[model samples]
Target chain A: MTVLDIQNLTVQFGGLKAVNGLNLQVQQGELRCLLGPNGAGKSTTLDLICGKTRATSGRILFDGADITNLAEYRRARHGIGRKFQVPSVFKELTVIENIEIARSRRPGLLAALTTFRTPLRGRVKEVLDRVALTDHIDSKAGNLSHGQTQWLEIAMLLAQDSKLILMDEPTAGMTIQETLKTAEIFNSLRGEHTIIVVEHDMQFVRQVAQRVTVMNQGSVLAEGTIAEIEADARVKAVYLGH
Target chain B: MNRTNHYDFLGYVAFAIIILLGVPFLLGFDGFELNTFARYLALAMVAMALALSWGTAGLLNLGQAATFGIGSYVMAMHLKLAASTGNPGGMPDFMGWTNVEALPWFWQPFQSLSVTLLAGLLLPAAVAGLMAIFMFRGRITGVFVAIITLAFMVALQLVFIEEQRFTGGQNGLTGLAPLELPGWTVDTYSLPFYYLVAGCLIVALLVGMLVVRSKVGLVLRAIREDAARLRYLGYDVAAYETFVFCLSAAIAGWAGMLYTLVLEFASPTYMSVSFSLAIVIWCAVGGRESLVWASVGAILVNLAEGRLSDMFVEGWLLILGLLFIFFVIFLPRGLYGLAVAAMDRLRRSPRTEPPVPVKEG
Candidate 1:
C-alpha cells in the first residue's frame, strides 16, 4: 500500500535544479526518515509531493491517485499534511480552536456557513490529549512554547486525519529534552499514520525512523537503516566529511 | 488570549439597540430636520462592511470607497435619468453638459427602478469579483493590497470624471425622484427614508455577524495570522480573501444605493481618498473588530464633524486627524476594545458566554 509515489520528480528554478529525477515511495503506516545535507532537495521533494511547488517534470501519486495537477489545498484534502521548518500555528486561535479548525472538511460556501461544527470538538480534544496539550487547550496558539508549537502542528495534522504526513525540520530549534519528548510523541504515532520526515538531526532520526534515505543534489544517494547509513563510507565522506 | 469580561457583551449590544431604536422619539422635537442620523445609518452599513472584512477577517481593503462609489453613482444615475424624462430631448443635465446625444446602454436600465436596483446590487459585485480574482490569487496582502485598492479608487474616480458623458463628471447627479413605496410617495429626506437606511444598516450588521461567526470567518482569521499554516490545513486562502472582498464590496454597494436616496446627490467626491480615509478613521475610532464600535464610530465622528465644523470650520480637520492619529498610536484596539479591556481588568473572573456558544469551532 504505497501512500505516496514519486517517479522521476524534479523541481527547477531557472538554471538551478532543486530536485532532480527523484524516485521515492512511502508505504502506509511507516515512519520514513529522509536525510540530506543543505540544498539536497529534501524539503523541495516534500514541497513537490505536497504541491507547494510544481514538479518541473514527473508524476506524483498519493493513495493510488495521480495528483500532479492538484493545488496545495486540494492535495491537503487528499490526506497530505505538511509541518513546516518553522513551527507554524494560527497565533490568534486557541489551541482547541486550532485543532478544531483542522477537523472540518466542509466544502462549498453555503455549507461552510450552514454546517454544524459540534462533532469536531471530540476529535480535537483527543488529538490534544495525544499531544499532551490539554492544559493549554484554551490558550492562544501563538503563546505556546517553541517545542509545543511543533507538537501542536502535529496534533493538527492528526486531527486532520491525513494518512501521510510531511515534516520539515520539526526539531530544528529545540533543546535535547524537548527533542526526546518530540521523539516519544513521534514514536507513539507510528502505527496509525505514515509520515515522511526531512530532518537534519541524526540522533532524532535514529530514534523512531524505521528506514532512512540519504539525498544529495535532489535525488536519493542511499537508502538503509540509520545504523547502515551512519556506517556507510560514502555517507561519511560526502555528508559528514570524515 | 481569552479575557474575562465583567459586563456582558450581548447585554451592551441590546442596550445600544434600545438607544438606537429610541432615537426617532429622542430627536422627534426637531422634526428629523435633514435627518442627519439616517445618513450616518446608511454610511454605517459601509462601516460595518469594513469592520467585517478588515477588523475580524484582517483584510486591508483600501478600495471600499471604490465599491461605495460604484453603488452610489449607480443609484444616482438611475434616479437622475428617471427624473430627466420630462425635460425633453431625453438627455440628462450632465450628459447634455458633456455634449452627449443619448443615454448609454448601461444607463438606460435606470428608466425602471427595478432594473436599477438589480444593477445597483450586481455592478459592484461584478467589479469586485473580477478584481479580486486577479489580486488575491496573486497572494497580494497587507499594505500592497491597501495601495492597490487605493489606486483602484483614484483610477475609478478618474474614469468617472473622464466619462463625463455618462457619469456626470465632477458636478455629479441630483434632483432624484422620491421613492415610490407600496402606496406612499415617501420623501427622500423624510423619516421614511431614515427608517429605510436604519433598516438596511441593521441588516448589513447582522449579515456581517453571520460572516464573522461562520467557518469561513475562522479560516479568514487564520489567513490573517498565518496563511501558510492555513494552506497546509487544506484551506483555500485566496478564495477566502476573494469571498470576503466581494462581500465587503456588495455591502458597500447596498449602502451606496440607500445613500443616494437620502443625500439626493452623488459626486466624484464619493471616490476621493479623503472620504476613504474618513471611513477608515471611523472604524479606527470606534474599534475595528467590533461591529457595534465601527458603526458607532461613524455616527459619532460624523455628528462631531457636524458640530465642530459649525464651531470652528478652519481647524476641525486638524482636530479630527489628530484624534484618529492619537487613537491608532495609543489605543490600537479602538474605543470599544479599550472599554472591553478596561472592564475586563476591573473583574478578576471571566464571564461564561453560554455552552456551545454558537460553536464556530
Candidate 2:
C-alpha cells in the first residue's frame, strides 16, 4: 500500500521554478533513495511532503489522507518525521531530554504541568540504546561529535514513533564507518517504517537504496532499482557526469 | 554531575529562606525599612515574571510593565470603589473630581475583591495570550517580539493617560482605601502588610520554580534553542511559546496587585518603557536563566539603587550604567554565573577538600 503520494507537485520562488511537476509515490515499509545533484529540488520535495515548504500547486496524500495544506506540526502528528541536513538536536538539553521532548505522546501545557514525571524516560533510554548513544544520554547535545549528533537526530525521529521518515542527506558529514552503521540502522528500520531519504553520496545510496529516483532541474529524470538507475545514461549524463 | 545546577538549586533555597524568614526576623527592620523592603520584593516578583518568558521560553517581552500596570490598576480600582461606599452616589473621589456622576461599567465588577483579584491575573494573561497568538502563530520572534510588546505597552499607557476621567489620567488611581480582608484591613506601612507582600513574593518565586524545574522547563529550553527542530518532532512550538508568555503575564499581574497594596496607588509611569527596561536589567543582573537569582538580583539592585541615589543623586544612574556594562562584558551570565564560578573554583581547589577522607577515625 502506498504511504505517500505526490501528484503534479510544483514549488516556485518568484521567477525561479524550484520544483515543477514532480510525481512520486512510496509504498508502506519501503526504503526509497532520492538522488540528485545540487539544486535538483530533492530537499524541497521532502519539505513539501512534510509541510515545511508549502507547494505552489500540488496534492500530498499521506496514509490515504490529504495533508497538502496541513500545518507542519499537524503533519508531524500524522506520523511524518523529517531529519534536516544539519543535525538539529536541542543543544542546551541533554540527549535524554531531547528524546523525551519527541517521545511525549501529547506535549500540551496541561500535560507538561500535571504529568509531573515523564513516563517515556524508559522509552527514551531504549531509543538512545538503539542509536548506540546510551552512554552519552546525560551529556548536553551540543557537546556531541558530528556523527553522534546525526545518530541523536535519528534517535529523535525514532522516539517520535513516526510512520514515515524523511531524511535529507543523512550521511553528509559522516565517516565511512559511521555511514555503514547508519546504513545498517536504516536497513533495520526499513520493514517497520516507510522512508524517503535524499542523498548525493553514491556509495551510501547504493548500500541503502532498494529503489532510486533521479531528479534534475526540479523534475524526475529516471526511476528504477539501484542497479538499473546506476546504469541509466540520462542519470549519468545529468547527475553522475564524468 | 552538573555542579552549576546543584549550586543554582542551593542558591534558590538560601534566597527563599532569607527573603521569607531571615529579613523579617533576623535583620530587625523598622517599619519604614520593612515597607521599603516590601516594595523591593514586589519589584523582584515582576523581574522573575519577565525571566520566565525571556530566559526560559526565549520570548523577549519588553512590555512586562504594561501587564503589571494593568494588574495594579485593577486592584487600585477595586480599592477606590470600596472606599467610595460612603459617598453620596458611591462614586470614587477621582470620578467625582472629573465630574462624573456614575461609575464606569468596567469598574462595577472590580467592586468585589474576589473579582478584582481574578481580573488582575486573568486580564493580563488573556491580553498576553492574544498577543502571543498573533505573534507566534505568524512566527514573529526575536527583536520583533520586543518591538511589538513595547509598542503595545506604550499605546496602553497613552490610553490610561488620556482617559483621565476613568483611570485618573497621568495621576493614575490613587487614594485607594486599605485592602479589606475577611478579618482585617491591610495597613499600607504596617508589618502585616509587609508580611502580605512577602508572602506574595514567596508564592511567585515558588510558581516560577515549579515551572523552571518541570519537564516543561526542559522543553521550553529546547524551544529557546531550536523551535524548528521541535516542530519536526511533532511538538506545537507556537502553543508552547504562547503558554509561557501568558504564564509570565499572569505572574507579572499578580505582582502588580501586591505592588498596589504597597504603594496604595497605580500610575501610568508603572507602564513606561523605562520601567519595563529596568525589569529586564534586574533579570540580566540576577541571571535571567535562574529564577531565584533573577528575583534576588532585582531586590538587591533596587536596594543598592536606593542607597546610591541617596548618596549620589546625579551620579547614581551613571554608576549603574557602568555596572551594567561591566556585567554584560565580564559577567555575561550575571551574578548567578559569578556565584557558580566561585563555587566551581572552590570545588577545584585542594584546600577546600577534607584531605581525602582521613584514616584517623
Tell me, by TM-score, which candidate is best: 2
* Tens-digit per-residue lDDT, B1-361, candidate 1: 2232123246336635743567777777243544777787777778878887898668778878889888998888777876787765666876776677777777777777777777777888888888888888898888988898899889999998887778777777777766665687767656666677777777777777667666777777777888766777787788888888888888889988888877889988988999898889999998887777788888889989988999988999999999999998998989887877776555635755432222211
Model 2 chain B: worst 10 consecutive residues (lDDT sum): B352-361
Best by DockQ: 1
DockQ of 2: 0.41
lDDT measured at residue B185 in model 2 versus the true structure, 0 to 100: 80
> lDDT of all predictions, in order shown?
0.79, 0.86
Looking at candidate 1, what is the lDDT of residue B132?
82
Model 2: what TM-score for its first chain? Answer: 0.95
How high is the lDDT of residue B185 in model 1? 77
Give the lDDT of residue B155 in candidate 2: 98
Query: Looking at candidate 1, what is the lDDT of residue B270?
Result: 86
